[model samples]
Target: MRELKILAVVVSLTLLTYYLVEPFAHSKMHPHVDAPNYNFPQADKVTDAENVEKAKVALEEAEKAGKEKAIKSAKTDLANAEKFEKDTNAFWASAKAAIADKGNVANGEVLVTSNCTACHSIESKGFPPVMDNASAAAAYGVVPPDLGTAGKLYTKDYLVGFIMNPARASKVTHKFVDGRVHPMPGFDWMQPQELADIVAYLESIAPKTMTDKEVFHNACQRCHSIKYGDMQKGTMQAFTPDANIKTYMGKVPPDLSQYIKSRGAKYIHEFVNDPQKHLEGTAMPRVGLTQASEKQVVGYLEKVGDSKKAQREELGPKFLIYLVIFAIFAWLWKSKQWREMH
Candidate 1:
């Protein structure tokens, strides 16, 4: 009876430990958010007539002050504003023209392989063309993402805009803590028809049904590895040499083997969508994955972290019932033994 009581106490303590530690681990992994919430400037607002008036006023003020630098800056701003107005009008015209043409997927595939495959991989198999992420990180600050899932992950309109002008599509300008800016260069050189074809090719190659596992493989596996039993999905090659780590990220990235258990699904979703939003100066840039893909990645993480979670939950009530019956029998046996003694 005493041994059984001790066993029950141990089990109760173990359950308590899990409950307490789980919450604490989650809290540490996902503290209160501190990063700035950036609102991207709309294209319409960028070329608004009011901005032209403001720039004109600033130009006059700077000229009156006789400040060459200020005057030059104001003039530059005014010129840019006017140019954007013109460009916006042209973009709409091109969009209308492109909408009528259903693009050639074959031509787009060729274009992607020729131009894009230099930095991004369309094929899911084998090492990517830009295999050296360390060197790529040194040059571009962040390793470029694989284009395997791009078609399914982004809308046609967004893909078109991003292909035309990456910087404009992603309006937020990310500045690193080391005073370096990491901006994606625009590809305004690609013609509208060419851009349309590339989008079509991407759509052609996109997975019809992207499982959660595929999401993790395509998006997270480049920098992270998941260990399921003895099987490993990706390599954990050093992002860069230790000497250059400070220049890039300031610290080595953590293994995400148990990230879901430690951080929780909500934390994973927010972090995956925008890492900088959770941790300022994090090396993990926003990969621009769709909300669905992000959720799928989180789901994959949860599965990896606790493969038997469903089974555990299903057995919980039955286990509790057994414990109750055992306790009653234990009490009854003890009572009977004491009664005999009396």
Candidate 2:
């Protein structure tokens, strides 16, 4: 009877102690922090001083972080944004006029082959796949017809407009001839001069062809970017950590791996080749490569930029499978210890 009473007393003491001390123990491990109150007249003055000091330190840290991010974002923006064309309208018109000129197509063709044809074949031989009418229509769900007979089929105005905004004119406006959407996107990155030169060359144009993971890396990397956008603009309150690579670019380099894709690469190339080329008053610079180098870079871009789509698509299942496996293992491991403790 005495032993039963003593046990009851011990249990009661434990319950009491737990109720009183458990809160503090939990608080120690995961503290509930709040800003100090400074509402009282005397208390407010003293707390205000401390708050001001803390705020100043925080502001300085934030400013330093901001500057770093701005510089890094500037680098990437400069690289990709440099290619955007100034006046898209002018670009198409000039290209039409230039292609009509005699030496233009020959020179442009030479430039295209020396730079572009290696990774991008003109006619549909077997080697590098051609992004011709049939394939393009099947892939994009619209017809771009064929560039093979672009000179014969399209007027300078039509050709120029098509090249300037392929999506708008080719997909949205025109009838589907080949049962494929045009694969060509806008070249908003070209400078006025570069656009004119390329357009003049394309006037009497022909056909073309195109590659792979290993072969892809070799041909498409130079002018092709796997990343885009200014990393410096967005931040979640100070010290909370930036949610993306752009946030870190101020302190560390930004990763271009996430943004690279066919669509993104095309956009990036345009930006790099021309700054004010898209909008009226843009501020990006041309990297100023020879025609051959530009084409090589574009080819390389097709490989690298295209790879990201496949890679990202694969990540979801992989992450979920791993997470489930980890949770199961954690449960199994903890079960033994729990039983032993009980």
Instruction: Give each model a TM-score.
Output: 0.58, 0.26
Return the number of clashes found in candidate 2. Answer: 45
The lDDT values for all models are 0.66, 0.41
Considering every candidate listed, which one attains the maximal TM-score? 1
Model 1: residue 231 alpha-carbon error in angstroms = 3.1
Summing lDDT over every window of 10 consecutive residues in candidate 2, give the lowest-scoring window. Answer: 235-244
Residue-pair clashes per candidate: 0, 45
lDDT of model 1 at position 103: 79
lDDT of 2 at 69: 75
Model 1: lDDT of residue 254: 64
In model 1, state the lDDT of residue 38.
Answer: 22
- TM-score: model 1 vs. ground truth: 0.58
Candidate 2 whole-model C-alpha lDDT, 0 to 1: 0.41
